[model samples]
Target: MDASSDRELPSTQEDLEIRAVSAERLTFFGDAVVAIALTLLALELPVPEGSTNSEMWHSATSHRDSYLAFMISFVVIAAHWRAHHRVFRHVTATNSRLTSFTMYWLLTLVITPFATDVIGGHGAFQFRFVFYAVVQSAACLLFLLMVREIPRDGLARPGTAPEIFSRSIHRAGMVALGFLISIPVSLVTRWAYVCWIVVPLVDSVIDARKGRTARQSSQD
Candidate 1:
């Protein structure tokens, strides 16, 4: 009989309680999107439409550099996404400024495949290298922005483990610097990807140590 009852419940506290829904969903979608993008690169991998092993090998060899670059890009994106995931894990809410920053990061993430395609053989343009550098730098800046957002939202207070996360972020910033450096380095080395390899390996060491420490700390 009450008009309030007839009006139906407005958006409930449950919805308000989950203020970080957009941030969570963005990270989730980013995980899937980067995954799909990486998988799609495999399709770009040269597969001879022929049956002869010689032809397949030859065709594949012609694409060997491209394939290698694709793999490198995959590693870079995976590392970036890994760092991004943990950064967002402590986030509890999102605002328009942070949302805009994510949009730019996503834009760079989405463009990686196109950059991979361009990175074919040893003949890719320096501009492509520049584009790659700039995109990665942008992602690094966004990563820093996300860290700053934590306190504003009263989410993850600055602490030891969070300091570990901060250290990981600092390493990512180094990778971004490496990416930028590779452009000029490519001016000398045919295998610029050789330098990029350091990113994943470094990320692995950092992540593995973190995982082990986390597991041990939990057990204790």
Candidate 2:
């Protein structure tokens, strides 16, 4: 082999540094955009026109179910966005594929309010239920793509303990599994919304465990 003909790799540290900076910006935008979606969606729902307390109470009370669904969906989207942000913060790559995946997932998220309306208004007809669940599920899958690429840039470097990677993967599995399972359940049960809550709970547990482990490692 002609040594001069062989090309050297770009500086890995330099690539990693640029990628890390871009990933932080992308993740920050993702968080803010999702939050904007929730707020705009909430505003689209109008309050009762009645001026009297009794009449307005009646009007507002009539839409309680819709309000409840909106509240639940909003919280789920917030939790999903928050976890996505955390994962990206630990990432070091922000290449074209990752950017595309984030765009795909965020595009799917933009329909969440419409899905919420369909599911809430029509109840769980198999079609609307499946559609709503599928939208969220697609977002979950795209997020998985974004996260699965995390270990590639030495963030999960040598001497990074196996337990940390294992726990992170396990947490991702919980989210993916919850979305996968909930799709069918949403089609079957009236209370399928409850299943979505499993994701946030899983996130919380993973975050708590991560915090405790880091503290212990630092103490040692």
Candidate 3:
């Protein structure tokens, strides 16, 4: 009984394949949780209240902050799901660490709707902004861990392109850095949103420079 219990990890390629099926089931579970989170986000949206068209238009304008927050959260969650899908596609096995990291990642996703509400609130601008940023940054970093785990633990499929993992890591890191940088900026000004928008453009520039350097090195 002790020897059988000690054998926690799969010992053969067949066992790895079997575990891959279980990992895929976990991915499906994650998809459902993400869908539920999105639903919760939409349900929290405030309806424009009015008796007439003009009044309704005015009410909508008044609730613009909530509308804007919903849109932002929607996009952020969708992007995270997309990245999650990409990472899990190459995954061929899993370990306890990967499972734990995935659950934590999902927890962040589930909290995003509440964070959106906080962002839409009227007072304590800096505190609310920083809180939202922190949630997003944690989500990004946790996802980076998930991405790294696949390769680190030999969880990815054979013949999978290495660039897939590298690209995901870089993007997650850039996004996390953007949110972290915005936290301090939020202390001084509401313009901190500029950080999230600009960081991707900066990442693109860096990638282009690296590609050029690589090509030149090959030529030399």
The TM-score leader among the candidates is 3
> Looking at model 1, which ten-residue stretch has the lowest summed lDDT?
151-160
lDDT of 2 by residue, 44-125 (tens): 5748758799999999888876787688678768867776765655655576777888888888778888877876674447
TM-score of each: 0.73, 0.73, 0.90
Backbone clash total, candidate 1: 0
Report lDDT per candidate: 0.70, 0.71, 0.92
* Model 1 score (lDDT): 0.70
lDDT of 3 at 173: 95
Identify the superior model by lDDT, candidate 1 or candidate 2. 2
Q: What is the C-alpha RMSD of each candidate to the true structure, in Å?
A: 5.8, 5.5, 4.3
Model 3 lDDT per residue over 44-75, tens place: 99999999999999999999999999999999
lDDT of 1 by residue, 34-124 (tens): 7877777677766555478887788778778788768877877887788877677766567777777777777777777777777664655
Regions of candidate 3 where Cα sits further than 4 Å from its true position:
1-14, 216-220
Candidate 1 residue runs with Cα over 4 Å from true position? 1-16, 121-125, 157-161, 198-220
Model 1 vs. true fold: TM = 0.73
1 versus 3: better lDDT goes to: 3
